[model samples]
Target: MNPTASSGRSPWPYPGPRPGDDDPAGGGQTIADVGEFELIDLVTKGLTENDQVELGPGDDAAIVRTRDGRTLCSVDILIEGVHFRRDWSSAMDIGRKAVAVNVSDIEAMGARPIGIVMGFSAPGDLSLTWVRYFIQGVREECDRAGVSLIGGDITKARDITISVTILGDVGPEGPVLRSGARPGDLVALKGRVGWAAAGLAALSRGFRTPKAVVEAQQVPQPPYGAGLEAARAGATAMIDVSDGLLGDLGHIAQRSHVTIDVHRSALGMPEPIRAVGQATGIDPYVYLLTGGEDHALAATFPPGALPEGWTVIGTVGESSTPGSWAVTVDGRPWEGRQGYDHFH
Candidate 1:
């Protein structure tokens, strides 16, 4: 049996990158036909993950420790055609995002990442160098987050898919869960919102966005270390905005049993995105409130938990049990669509 077992197998037994080879498949039976390991090895070719991890790849399982007795972990998956497409994103960009977003979630929890485990499924035709570059992307991102990648599985499939699971140490302090927000808690956010949606709009409509917007879609550089800062600064409850703001805040609301009111007055504005809204006839609020993949941190504070990069978005109120999941723009009952239903 392969060492990885159920996790999958290495696609290529040879080391990183084969010159003149230009595809993930290695020009043979499709990736699914080779199964998992071979395909993962093909894509993950490259420099080793950080040495911090106790067990790095190739085993029945990988191991990392949680000194605080609690482990803060989160997982996010990207489907080839749904979440991202190889056509728009390079292997490196995809790799970077796969790592960055996971770290962002760990940060949002008010913890620091200890290690990462990744699961990749792809076609057999991709090139070997592509895999190495992808790992490099993960390593570079892990370096930024002060974490190392322990290991993960590689598999062959009909399409490209990446699932990243991050493990974090809660330290002795926080794991600011969603249920901790209290009434009168101040709403705060780190990292810009709506930009990724704008970039997606630009791509979908073929609108040439400024470099910044396009970059937003390709690789999101969330405010690094901000989650721990927020935690240390005393964030009561926190969450990462992987979903739209209203949609994500609904999480805080449901967990904290409060109503969340978003202030439109404080929104970040620029001509290109506003112009994109006008051109595409899509509401900017939709982008601001419903867009996902921004991976920004949204947390609640008891009274004053303001950090340098944090912005006040709104407040936590009595539960919406009276029939309002969110507050209206004008402070009335927000009874519109609850936003983002993953199934449809």
Candidate 2:
């Protein structure tokens, strides 16, 4: 809402609301409302720690152990009005998403995330209670992912921004990489795709569907154990569906120098996606091909049938062949929205 129209100023629904009501508290209190040390203290209370995090929260950096020889790490940032706005998400929602997306990278690498490092910045007047609630969401997700909070920092800034870096371990199995795929392999996924984008579209258009789709845009439902399952299933190249499936698959295709063909009909959420498309007047396939942040596990399986929950979305073909590195929905060529580009 426009600031002047509100009580002097208002909270951002800069993106709009879910349905019935909107509130101004999303902005929290000003910095003077809670002193920095007090604010920091509030956010750090009641966190769950792990054995690996011997020293956590409050030091210059948190310390963690890697019993294995190496650690896999991934980082992600959510910025106000950019990655998300208060109007579209709650503190708890953002916190859960901040953690889930970071862990999805670890999942993509065929590892289990063990720890997190967070950096948060917000206006000086932000509420200590709100920050604490955000951390509660993080803790809730960490419990699901079996991760612990090693450490993090808090500071006042012009806008609300949060970044999380996850540290994961794969034990003796090692991590999966982009270039390991080859020709003649079946491409597959473990979770739903395009739902997050569908939800985002709904929010953008002032529409409200099931809370399931709305929650998807706030925090995706990833295939929790599928990453490691794929690794054990002999998946060669693997990635999280952080970007649109087709676009992300393009990354693997380009990196592995293989052609990727997606069997669009096999996607898991065809019915729901089509329903969303019908409600919004968009092609449901567009959401599957270009929507992202579903955190589905996409991988290459050596010539064979797929595993349970895994669909053979496409096949890998020789890169040397004509029109190699191509990704299509159905037999026709598909060129649609690429995933999020930070520089844009």
Candidate 3:
């Protein structure tokens, strides 16, 4: 069962039709049929091992090198039914999402991801076909980000959960932190906001949301390569909009002791999101201000110095009010929910 790269036997056919595509009825082959080792071999096939990977997969641990002699790392975990539901997302979406979220964290630090390692816990009875597609999803995402999946572990569990850890390089400029924002800095963002939340809301309410909205909810596309560009352009502070714009920005406010004032007029909700709000009778602003899991990068930069593909949303100012820091809309404190919290 210990199938290695040199084993000379491939468990499944790749570069062909995807799993279950041949048998749309999903003929009964489960993970038990393929076993863990064979599953590993199938997934690891064709994965590019970059020069940074001193020791790639098939080993107990992987060794990755950083160009700057310093490394930045971040981890994110997605549990079935908590972060996503299989009924709502395809295996490909789930896999891509798992990596995208982790990559977003590395991007938030203004770093370029070099390697990724994943740990998958799944039910032994799960379909082998499904598992293969999931791995394809993971591999595809890694390729999209120009990084390699160095190594990972698979095991049996009650439910599917993916733990992804990404390693990144910050180069000479250094990693961006949430604490660097200062008064007079411009608050800006790259990529969409509130679309995921709006899509999630539609799914919850059983509303037939737009295809774009649904895709946004299931598979997020973080502005790749923009983080490093921002850092190179002298971005003071940065964060990924994972748990809503205000909530994520609040992290910067708290860390840097600055108040961020968002100009609502300038932060217009996209047409798709506005349409969702109109259909659902929900305020688009609610989604824009408090929605989460968008994976967009929100940053603060000097006036007139915002990087390309970034939109100015607000301005940072000295925190002269109560609490450690604050966020306001048009100079007024927001009274609604700031962002998502795991616990109430």
Candidate number of the best lDDT: 3
- Model 3, span 231-289: residue lDDT tens: 98899999999999989999999999999999998877688888888878888999999
Task: Give the candidates in order of lDDT, highest first.
Answer: 3, 2, 1
lDDT head-to-head 1 vs 3, winner: 3
User: Candidate 3's C-alpha lDDT?
Assistant: 0.84
**lDDT tens per residue, model 1, 145-197:** 77776777776677778899999888866888887887798898888787788
* lDDT, residue 121, candidate 3: 89
Residue by residue across 1-344, what tens digits does model 2's lDDT show? Answer: 01123234344342332212232345545555767787667667777787777777888887777777577778998898887766667767778889899989998988878899988888866655456557777878888888898877877788889989999888665577877788899898888788888888877876545446766898887888788888877889999988788889889988888888888667755565677788788988788878888888899989764568787888887865644576666655776566767676
Give Cα-based local distance difference scores for all models.
Answer: 0.73, 0.77, 0.84
Candidate 1 Cα outliers beyond 4 Å, as residue runs: 1-52, 320-327, 333-338
lDDT assessment of candidate 1: 0.73
Displacement of the residue 62 alpha carbon in candidate 1, Å: 1.5
Number of backbone clashes in candidate 2 = 6
Residue 155 of model 2: what lDDT? 77
Q: Clashes in candidate 1: how many? A: 20
List candidate 3 segments past 4 Å from native.
Answer: 1-26, 321-323
